[model samples]
Target: MAYAIIETGGKQLKVEPGRFYDVELLHEEEDAAISIDQVLLVSDGSTVTVGRPLVEGAVVEATVMQHRRDKKIIVYKMQPKKKTRKKQGHRQELTRLMINSISVGGKALATA
Candidate 1:
């Protein structure tokens, strides 16, 4: 029941150990380790800690699984009487990560 809210790739996510998540693309080799310190909130079942902007000494560890692109989305536009039309498709780059652990003040709070 331990979890933390972290900021990355201009987004906030609720994460827990042993879970896989896809976020904005990361320029790292597969299997590379990374630690995120932009923790906004954390809960360890018994207590909760909230940060003003970011929690001090709070870190989340993860490993890069792979890099991929998300499903394509289409955009279409048309004009009446002008016969003008446009169509476009776009995909977002993403990175897959496996959360390994969550810690606070150098003490492990959750582990995969």
Candidate 2:
């Protein structure tokens, strides 16, 4: 199988064509095309390329599928004998992306 390691939203992901991924929030409308260039590694079943920091001319193309919030998480705090308590809930915003293709040196290497 062909895949690539891409960095985005302060995290790295192992991505393949035709797959969907939920990542940190992105400031873009749904269906917008995005290209990620911070590719750390790429493998085509037989060959593998590893970047020092990032691979030159490597890009991963994706489309924004949706924007949504993750599951809610609750935080509670209490102070013993102080009658102090706090409660909070949070839901992180996230973006859904559909990976389209992976390319290097302007040549397409893999596609969905």
The local distance difference test score of each candidate is: 0.97, 0.96
Number of colliding residue pairs in each model = 0, 0
Question: What is the lDDT, from 0 to 100, of the residue 47 in candidate 2?
Answer: 95
Model 1 reaches what TM-score against the true structure?
Answer: 0.98
Q: What would the per-residue lDDT of candidate 1 be over residues 16-84, giving only the tens digit for each residue? A: 999999999989999999999999999998999999988899999999999999999999999999999
Off by over 4 Å in 1: none
Best of the candidates, TM-score: 1
Top model number, lDDT = 1
lDDT for each residue of candidate 2 in 1-112, tens digit (9 for 90 to 100): 8899999899999999999999999999999999999999998889999999898899999999999999999999999999999999999999999999999899888999
Candidate 1 whole-model C-alpha lDDT, 0 to 1: 0.97
Error of 2 at 57 (Å): 0.6
RMSD of 1: 0.6
